[model samples]
Target: MNKKYNIMLLLLLIIISPISYTYNNDFIIRTSVDMKYAFCDVKTNGVSGANNRSSVSRGGIGFGSTSTNSMILMENGENTITIELASLNWFSQDDIPQKERNIFHPNARCEIVVNKMDDQGNIIPLTQLMVKINEDGQPEAYENNKIDSSIEKKIILASNTEKIESDKILERVNAKEYPKDMTVFQFNKKINISDLPKWPWVEADKYEDTPKQRELLQAAYLELWTAFEQQDDSKIKQLLTPSLEVWAASTGGNVEEQFASREIGESFSKQNFQMIPINWNNFQPLIMNNGKMVKLVYKEDFDFSPVSYRFTTEKGTSRVAYHSPIFSFVNGKFIPVI
Candidate 1:
C-alpha cells in the first residue's frame, strides 16, 4: 500500500507542476483595448409629433459584464499566454465627456479591440471593431436618429498579434486608421461626413436657365428670403402645397412655431447675415417652353452659417432655378411647395 501511494503522488505532481508553471511563468501578457461592448435601446413616451418621436437610450452596457470567461488561450512552444479583458460600464452621452469618448474620435470605437504584449513586454494589435447599435422605437429604422446610428464595435485578438506587415491586417479590414504600435492596439479611421451627404443634404445638382429669367428668379428668391426672415408663416404658406400645409400643421409647422421657440431673431441686425446664392440650383424652367419648369430650393444654410440672412444685402448668387417645377410656378415664380 505504501509503494502504490508514492507512485500515485509522483504522477499527480508531474501532471500539476506543468500547469502551475505554465500559468505563472509562461509568456507575459497585457490588454490594450477597452474590451466591453453590449447595448440596449431606450425609449421615451412624452412627445406627440417630431418631439414625441425621439428616444434617448439609458443603461446601454448594463451590469455584470465579464472578461475572465471570454479570455482566449495562446500556446507557443513551452510558453503559454492568457489574454483577458474587462467588462464594459455604459452611460449616455451626458454621462461621459464626448471628447474623451471620441479620443481616437471616430477611429476609436466600442467594438472589440485586441492587443498583444510580447515576451519582452512589447505591445501589438490583432483585431478591433467598434460596438454597433440599433435605436429602439425609431420611426425610421435606417435613419440617422441619435439613438439609431451605431458607433461600430471593435475587437482585437491578442494571441493573433504579429509584427509582420501590420498594414496587411489594416488592409484586410479596410481599417479607418492604423495603430501607432504594431504590438499595441490600433484604431480604424472615422467615417467621413462627405461620404454620407444625407445629414447636411448638400450635394445634388438640378436645373439651368436663360439669363433673362435670372432676374425674375432672383426677385422671387428675395421675396422668399424676406418671408422666412420675417417669420411670416403666411408668405411661407403661399409657397406650400395643400397637403404640405396639413403635414406642416401636423408638426406645428409655422415659422413662429419653428424658429420663434428658439428666439432666433426678430429682424435683420446685419447687412451680411449670410450668403445664400450658393444653395440655389437646377435653374432651368420647370414647365416653360424654353425649359421653364425650374426649382428654387429654400431651406436653412447647412454650410454652418447663421440662420438669419435677414440683414444681409441678400445679393450675390441665389439658388433661383428658371422655369422650375420643383416649386410650383405661381405668377412666374419657382416655388417648391407644390
Candidate 2:
C-alpha cells in the first residue's frame, strides 16, 4: 500500500510540473519617459503594447510625460523588441518655437525595465534599458526626424538566463487573434446615417448628457461617418484637429514632406478600409477628457477588434477595428482631437 501511494504522488508531480513553469514564465514590461512633451510606443516580439502619450503643450501650457506597464509572454528563445519615442512638441511646430522644440535632445530620456514574478509572487528584476536622444548613434538604435527615434533589440530568454543583443545580461518580455469561422462584412456599401439605430451611451459618474449635447454629438458623428463612406479627404480635414493631422503624417512613413500633402483618404484606402463594416450596435458613446471629448468605443472590453469586425485577409484572417479620432465638443460643433 505504501508503494502504491508513492507511485500516485510521483504521477501527480509529472502532470503538474509543466503547468507551473508556464504560468510563471511571462515577463512584465515597465516603460517610463520624462520630457517636456513626448509619446512612447514599445513592442515585444512584434506585438505592440505599453504605449503612452502625453498631451501636447507649449511653454505656458506646461510639460508632457508618460509612465505605463504591460505584460509580455515569451517562447523561451530569441525575441524581437522595438521602441519608438517622439517629442510631441516637435509636432506642434506652428505653436511651439523651433528652439523650444528640442526634438531628441539630451534632456529627454525613456527607460524600459523587464521583470518576472516568481511562484511566490515576488518581483525579480531581469534587465533595464534606457534611451537618451543623445545616444542615437548606438549600434541597435536609429533616428528619423520625420517619424520618431527607434531602437531594435533581440533578446534570448530561457529558464536559466536572459541575454540581450548587445551582450548585456538581464531580464524580461496581441495583435488580437481573430476567430477561425468569423463572418466578413464588407464596408464598401453606403448606408444612410439617419437610418441607423441610436447606440447606448456609457454612463460616466462625472459627466451628464443633455438633449442639446446629444444632438450636437450625433450630428458630428454622422457628418464624419458620411465623409468616411464617401472618402472625402477635404471634409475629413475640416473635422480633424491640426494636432491629429500632424500625428497621422508622422506615423505614415516618409510619405510627404508636409502634413497637408498626405491625403488622409488615400491613406485610409491603403489600409483596406473596404474590408471593415460599420456596426452601429457595437458602438457606445463614451465621454472622456473631463467631458471635453466624446469617443465612440466598443461596449465589450474596448479592443480594436471586438470579434464582430473580423475579416478575411491574404494572410488568413484579420480584424479592422475603429476607436480613436475622439471628438471634442467645441463652439457648438464636434471636432476630432486625437
For all candidates, the clash counts are 70, 3
lDDT by candidate, in order shown: 0.26, 0.35
Error of 2 at 284 (Å): 2.7
Cα lDDT tens digits, model 1, 304-332, are 11111313224532221111112323333
Candidate 1 TM-score versus the reference = 0.23
Q: What C-alpha root-mean-square deviation, in Å, does candidate 1 show against the real structure? A: 29.6
Give the worst 10-residue stretch by lDDT in candidate 1: 9-18
Candidate 2 wrong stretches, greater than 4 Å: 1-207, 244-272, 275-281, 304-312
Q: What TM-score would each prediction reach against the true structure?
A: 0.23, 0.34
For model 1, the local distance difference test gives 0.26
What is the per-residue lDDT of model 2 for residues 1-338, given as tens digits with 9 covering 90 to 100? 00000111000000001111112122233334333323444444333344443233222222434543323212233433445455445444265555544444355444555554443667765544454454552212323333223333422211111122431111111101111121211101111111111111111122346767666655655665566566666554444434332232322222132235434444354434442344445455665434644555443323221112222344544334332444555434554433
